[model samples]
Target: MTPAKTQFSLPDDFNPETLMVAKVTEFGVFHEVRRAAHLAADLVANGAPADLDLAEQILAQVLDRQEHDPADPHHGNFYWMREDEFVEDLNAVEFVLEALIPMMIRHAARLTPALQERLLAAIKLGLMEVARLDVLVAYTNIAALGVLNTCLGGELLQTPEIATRGFGKLLAWIDYTNRSGHPLEYNSPTYTAVTLRSLKLLTDLTADAPTRQAARALTARLGLSAALHIHSGTGRWAGPHGRAYQPTIVCETAPEVERLRAWLTDGTLPRWLASFVDRPMASFSIQETAERSRGIALTTHQTPTFALGVASQSFHPQANVLMLHYARPNAPRPGVLYSRYLLDDKWFGDAYHATDRTKMLNLPDEGRFLGVQEVNRAIGLYAQIGADHFASAKGVLIWTGRDEIDEIWVGEECITELPHRLDVDQAVVVARR
Candidate 1:
């Protein structure tokens, strides 16, 4: 049944007409439509006539689910999941295009006439929705991706108006980034990867010279920002991430690093940026600062053996404020030190567990102040007033390699437990390895 459900196989007893009903009707139906879309595209590209027919059927079913009501907010978008009939996924319209646009570009001639007409209409609808949403420049990843969707859709549909809007947004984003000294979602491992993919798509698909040039320059700048944070000894993204999940050592195999390497090798980036990526591991040390936005500042210090990163303040759900990563000989990854607040006994903003945002509290500007006094400062302190915010002032968390660290001290007391709550108003934390 369903060919034993290989990674991309459709469900057994699946019918193009009733798949959605069956999914909702059944208790644990397990089909991944996104993977199926990619699979269908692959089959259409290279499979036999029977396979091509099967691919078309899958694509047709997917297309039927797009919301088509002119008055609906999700007019051109698909549900985040098939069972979701009412909710709208804001990012779905462009992301679905990521799979669909390339198919039209490469295999439009092969598709049957009816399928081609339907596909063309769907792309146009999605493009119009993207223009209506008009994501702001500050929301970096989606804004970059929206630009690509509109520009590419315009090119595909021979609609100059859509292309013009896309280009205007692109220029505005460039201006905002230039003024801010960094992308608004700066140094994010997860989102930077998404932005890189979108930038690459714009450079590859759009014929507009100015848009292509702008995308290339932005790609190069983001690449350099990443290269500076990569610790030579540990081969990890040295932190103070504007947005990141729980993982401490995001490595070379990560999507962002892979994309950065691809951009660096193309020979279009500046020589210095490329050279730094190719540079040998040696006694290197440097401090970098960026005016993150109007009021916040980010500073990072990286050496061959260790790295320390701090943000003056942040509001991101997973902001990595005051992070330290150090080398550990023969270990798979680096030793780590980072801060996490405790809210109602749960780690604040813990990505692993679903936490309630309403009950959780954020630090006030005066309370959230964090910094490293000097470039190589080993001892650092984070001040937070817990009276206003219901969360407790939990001190730093540490993960050490074999023999990397024997003890940690918060003020004068040796910390015996992890994530110790410092009782005083100001606590100085130190990690000794």
Candidate 2:
């Protein structure tokens, strides 16, 4: 099947004058490199003389940002921002290759000989960085894209060793996911879309039959997981997410949702499962053991009116360890309730120090208690810790909705106010509708 032409254009927020400016202290815009690569590719595909010259300028800007020092471990990688000499994110390569690899496959011949050589060398360096970094498959999005970058890069550059390793990593991810019941970054509304896109790329582009077949099956599995969790009433990706940046899915036409919808409507799902997509969902419960030994069992319960999600163990800051989403009357969006740990008035899962900003370590602070739930009603317990562990310890339960709260109870205590701050340590807390 012939692919439809993508009408590429600059982002709405694009600033031509400040395009080259770099911020010193903060992390650079992540999409800058990606957009530049995409623009360059689009211009080259246009094949006009002026377009080719502009593409060269953009490519030059992108290549100049790459770290070329042979002795440096971060060689061939771009910094978090142009002014960031000290920090570099490994995922930079993954993001770049999302556009770069496909461009190389489709429009390499269109590129001027000189520019083509330069772009090819830059991509090879990027792939080398990916090889050295070796992102764990548990990361879901980056790992899947890393596999694609290396495999596709190998095929493009004729490096069999890299391709072989990429294939091996792909198989390992499949094996690990099958055993764990889901990816380590499970039920993430944000990263799941990225992972699915990577898997779709692998399924479409890989020459290897086994890899292609595996990717297709895995895509379907993830799609099923995503389809199940979407709240039928509110149209929100239901809670108990292993990772989520926002509390709720406010927009039904969100890019991630659209991507998933496209794949689902393409007749990939079975007839029985496809029925669930169009019909109203009544009630369901799903339990997934993300990791058996570490006790990361995730459970989500969904009904038409409300949904409850619980995690046996704490994850990253993006995690919703305990979450409740309920339908709001006369409102299209759902109500959100979730939990997070705070230390010294800061999120505990956040980077503890400035140095750990780019790579946040998942510290072992497993003092959190498990939650028990039956449909919308749930109970959560928190354990107390000494000052030695955390400078200031507190657990924050955030609630967002349009409804007025009539009452809140924590083990027979009637909490009379909204934004209730209380010591939940060694106490059972419950909320009901």
Candidate 3:
């Protein structure tokens, strides 16, 4: 078959100005990720009925999709509509190949060594292929291979090769994230859950390997970084500060989600990973410039009743601003977010995405939570955002609004600039749900 030519012309109505194509995923694959993940979790928890029959069935489904044409055309083909699909695909591979396949081979009686070898070869090729296209995802793909090598054999196919690079890079990323105090993986709202699953896979797969100790350390540090957002009252996520969330089928109905719920409700990660995390800290702080050059500086304060994720800038010119989460106890993983902005709840209503980037302060950070406002520049319309350190019970943000913009925003939703040039200070308090 002749290679398909790639060509496209923007339509007359297409607005290049409005298109932020990088944020979109041309296809969705997380449903299978979640399903495959749940199957693995179930097998781990308790599922040896008939030599792990249920687990085997799930593994077969994943392998079949490995070669089959996906319902979404972008998935099967080498070419992609956008780069994030590459991310989606590699993440999918992490769930199935890195995650499910290893668990099955380790425990399930039905998955033979011969079958495992075939799957490993195919996965290796996919990682190489995708690496050629997008190296970032390849970084993760290498970690996936490391995991495969760990479960299948000590001296597996790619040992001391791509496996080493992948493990090393991932550890470095964890180190940078923790040390710099910057939000990671795009500083995405749903990222904590997404990343937690991956770390869990890596940690569990390499249980006996040389990399296990480092992997466990990275996992613990990452968990702490993410846990800063868990709310004590509502147990929901804070808000989408970076990219707005892409729809994923990894929902509450998933068995894995249920398992996580059970664990968060009364337990920590399986004893091994949990050994370090131990108990939730009273409060921890994170302040840094994010990895992708996006600006983010935030702090988390956890009281027995409320875990507050606090930040200076909720929106900035370069970085997606931070949104704080104060969750109810035992709510759920990736719980509903506590809003950071004091929006007109009657006008805008209390929604999860409400705390997204609105026209706000562009306070650049020099480090350690101080965003200096010059009064001349702004992220969009708002001039500056900073936390009022005077009070402790509620969140108080001191903001300097744009004085010249008059009535800022498009129309009815538009906010009127403050009559005065000084910062408008208010307290951000979370209610007990």
lDDT of 2 by residue, 289-332 (tens): 88655768878898888778888776565677788777877765
**Candidates' C-alpha lDDT:** 0.66, 0.70, 0.39
lDDT of 1 by residue, 1-433 (tens): 4243223345555545633223322134433344456556766676566667877887776686688888887788765455456434577777777667767777888789999999899989888778888888988888988888877778888888988888888889888887777776778777787787788778877888998998888877777887776666666676777776554333324423344456666643445675666557765444444444446566777777887877766556467766777776765656776665444355333222211112223221223445553676644455555456564444445444425567767667887766465565756455555
lDDT of 1 at 374: 60
**Which candidate tops lDDT?**
2
Candidate number with the higher TM-score (1 or 3): 1
Decoy 3 TM-score against native = 0.50
Better of 2 and 3 by lDDT: 2
Best by TM-score: 2
Task: State every prediction's TM-score relative to the real structure.
Answer: 0.78, 0.82, 0.50
Q: Which residue ranges in model 3 land beyond 4 Å of their true spot? A: 1-58, 67-90, 112-114, 133-159, 186-189, 207-210, 233-289, 301-433
Model 2 residue 27 distance off true place after TM-score fit, in angstroms: 9.1
**Total colliding residue pairs, candidate 2:** 0
Itemize residue pairs with steric clashes in candidate 1: none
User: lDDT: which is higher, 1 or 2?
Assistant: 2
C-alpha lDDT of residue 41 in model 2: 73
